[model samples]
Target: MEEKILLKYIDVPDIEKIEVYQKHDGYKGLAKALKQHKPDQIIELVKASGLRGRGGAGFPAGLKWSFVPKDSGKPVFLCCNADEGEPGTFKDRLLMEKNPHQLIEGIVITAYAVNCHQAYIYIRGEFSQAMKVLEQAIEEAYEHNCLGKNILKQGFHLELSLHSGAGSYIAGEETGLLESLEGKRAEPRLKPPFPASVGLFKGPTVINNVETLSNVPHIIMRGPEWFKGFGTEKSTGTKLFCLSGHINKPGVYELPMGVPLKELINNYGGGIIGGRKLKAVIPGGSSTPVLTAEQVEEVAMDFESLQAAGSMLGSAGVIVMDETTCMVDALANLTRFYAHESCGQCTPCREGVSWMAKIARRIEEGKGLEGDLELLLDICDNISFKTLCPMGDAAIGPVVSFITKFRSEFEDHIRQGRCPIEKDKSIKVRG
Candidate 1:
């Protein structure tokens, strides 16, 4: 069984409450850190643990934290990117809704490490339940003196706030999120002054994913060596995989980082829905490339392994597709979403995304032009690595991957003027 750290008390009743959470060694790590360890010591412990950002990027948390300028005569900020906007990703929502205090403890310790006086939880607008839960948790923390002035009598003052985004996918980007939080339009800003040195109203800032911060308390309590024992040398820690799509059991599962993809499908997900044979899978959310059944066998659920298999472990949203699924239609559906969500800031992402969506819709609906395939790839070439933020790259990920991996399916859709399988049997269309 995978060792549960964040979800250790997953089944405990009322784990969202401070009282219940306190009974289960919840704020114990915060108490220990505030009392026993200095901010530098806590940072060192995290650096040794090898924990990466759980929110798609997989960047090392400690390295990211280390970038904050210590001597800057400004109050630093920590913003939790709780905007769970990625399709098929609800793991953060699950964490927030079930155990908001666990995340709160993490925020307190991380604030101490980075010397951030003020913090904000930038939650998604759609996650009303998660917002309510987090608000309640923050209130509870304030009530118990876990937050605000002179936290735990350590002379470390912190004020945590909750802010909700207007449901823009671009806001999920750190710079874009900063812009939104500052009461401006949500759009990606230029880098180099990066969020570390300058962010959130011209102050040094640190933004962490909800799941990433939730691990801090555990890493401190369990020690780095113990934390490193569960996963591979490089990818050390359990990962919360958002398993969905054409599966018998589809939900957020906390599994060891190196667990095989096949194991997650069979052992944890109970195989594909209706016991159908697996055709392809979006190994990590809608933004990642889809993997054919043959390619998924040798893959492990970590950053490096999936990248090696011509895909990314983005958000770890495992969207499984059975044999009866249509790749063109799936790509078209996902393209539609990207098209709708594009912030219309960069011309390439704003304009190029619409092109891909149109071309994909044309192909999926059996109205594909003769040169549509080449045109789709051309659009992808212009979009990926060209736009302001990764929204452009994310928009092209599925488009290029679908054509590359499932070329036959896409071609068949054009040739047959309909999904080939759908001609004989009914096929489910998924976004």
Candidate 2:
């Protein structure tokens, strides 16, 4: 069953308005935090909740907040990553557009907990409607004493701003987002001086994803144990799973974190479209490895569970594929995306992904040679874990997974000089 916490009031009429949101206990968490809890207390509460980052990396949120130095002699900043750049993810966009105040409340509460007086939401450039909605919500927050000086008359001040990214996929990376927020090219930076220590103008900074921050208010209002009741002990709380491709219902669904993949596909997603047999599932965003039908049956949708099954619960962007979908064609499309978004900062990723794209496209186009698959695997070896950032590994995930899982399909395309699925059907390829 769906456990809609962050998205609880998303469908309510006029829920974006401050009055309506407040009526539904919108800023109650902020009120509770300011009235009853100290900044450190709030952080401890979050820590107790075990709320992990909802972005690709499942790092603990409170643990990240605690990394910011209290006596750094510099102002702390909180950056809410609203850049929903992953291919099969639309959960953040929906949260921002439909219930802006929920996100605003969460942001303000998180800012208070982290002792940040100034915060920013780095949203995707293409999300104009979400931008406009958030702008209005911010204005309402200030008017309602949820932001600005002496928030709720509790001696806390905050200034919130929104930044639109130039649609760079790499900016979705936390360090890269910080660089872009600083008006530089969106490239991932080297770690060691991680964001919590020296970030956003060299001040101690805390960056949280939209979905991650949006859960803060709920944790504060209901307490950590109440939040923990929803999902697994480690992966506590609900998750927004963006279901897409070859599903009967392709949209974001909020459910407990460890919901079985089969349950999500059948009960929530309404099963494969047109009654087609399930072939595979991308259990996370495009960056994660693909899961075959048998693997999907045994897996659950959570960080630890997916990782145990050789895939990460990355952004929880679930892309389903049916039997008619050609794996070779699908991989070619994914390789092209990673190739184009490499930022050129890493040679292994830049050149390796380009080579993978060309090789996959050749295979899909029926021009593949006997040694092409081996060459692709060789490129994967050179790229994976060899670049400065995870982009190299992410770029090769689908390439290696596809070939490893569906070698016969690639072989059929090569030997038959055409997509086997295409030769058998007049329908368009799902890829």
Candidate 3:
């Protein structure tokens, strides 16, 4: 395997403990940040490293931090987005479960660099195990003086809290998370005032994904040159890819950013399950557009490469499918999820998602009429940029991609009034 940066010491004994973590160079970056570098220096180092958000958006981390007004006079808050509610994505869960202090240390270092004294980790409500683990880790940080008051007597006072969301998928969005953190209904806010300028109680806030912040200590320790040496020039460093679906070995794998998709499937994932032929894949998470088996033949798994291939490396959740899987059924299942997860904050998302789900379900059930395919595309077109948040666009991505890529399947459903691919009662659609 490629070099393991984030998951290097993940299997160490008692790595959750501060002393054990310290033995493995944990908090070394925080120590360096407190003593040697100023806040802007850290931001410059991040900018030089070319680190991007590991969240679905993949925004530049340093550019994002730079947007915070230094002289706004209002207190800046750094909120960690731990709401890993994306379908087929579970890499963040492993990070929090095995190495909670890693996240804590990353948070402290980021808060220091941003001149923020207070931070919050908005974790998903469903991850009860991860929440308990992080809470214990936070208490341990306080005990070790790594979180509260002056840390290592360097005059850096940071207060970190663990806030849990109400199991709403919309809360994973940055503005939606901020709104939910304030005890309001989980929904997205408008742009232009963006999170960097106006966020978390109308103060400057830097909201970063758990994986994004986790890269900070490593960057501070290894330097920008070292971090940029691995991945593509535009998309640097390694990424944690959450592999799921019909692959033989379905789990999370940390790899260099530009590794080819075929190698990840054939070598790391041990190829298709039951020796089945590959069918289709949702290159990233469910929200990203799907790719055919031929499309995944030789594409590199990076932000640029995937985008070049008409998809994205979003959240790096690779959902594979075999020849037996029906595209219509798969899209129907995905649309159902987005439909249910919609925050109902906008007309296109609120009403459009449900309409897409109903249409997909009708087609998957072999009741599709003649104009169903175009109608599905039309609904997606209306929902694309018409909603308050990206949820509307995200909801429509799969519908459009599946039909556009595999028009034959939807046509077969309409023509035959049943799934063309025969299946026994035991074999169900892989959602």
Provide C-alpha RMSD values for all models, in order: 2.1, 2.1, 1.9
Query: Which segments of candidate 1 are over 4 A away from where they belong?
Result: 423-431
Model 3 misplacement above 4 A:
423-431
TM-score (all chains, Cα) for each model: 0.97, 0.97, 0.98
lDDT per residue as tens, model 3, 279-344: 998988999999999999978899999999989999999999998888888888999999999998
lDDT of 2 by residue, 202-287 (tens): 99999999999889999999999999999998999999999998888888899998999999999989898878899999988998
lDDT (C-alpha, whole model) for all candidates: 0.89, 0.91, 0.91
Q: How much is the lDDT of residue 389 in candidate 2?
A: 76
Best by TM-score: 3
Return whichever of 2 and 3 wins on TM-score. Answer: 3
Count of backbone clashes, every candidate in sequence:
0, 0, 0
After superposing all C-alphas onto the true structure, candidate 2 shows an RMSD in angstroms of 2.1
Better of 1 and 2 by lDDT: 2
- At residue 73, candidate 1 shows an lDDT of 96
Q: Model 2: runs farther than 4 Å from truth?
A: 423-431
Give the C-alpha miss distance for residue 392 in model 1, angstroms: 0.7
Global Cα lDDT for candidate 2: 0.91
Candidate 1 weakest lDDT stretch, 10 residues:
422-431
Per-residue CA lDDT of model 1 for 213-329, tens digit only, reads: 999999888899999997889898999988888888888889879889999989999888776888888888899988889988889889899999989888999998888778887
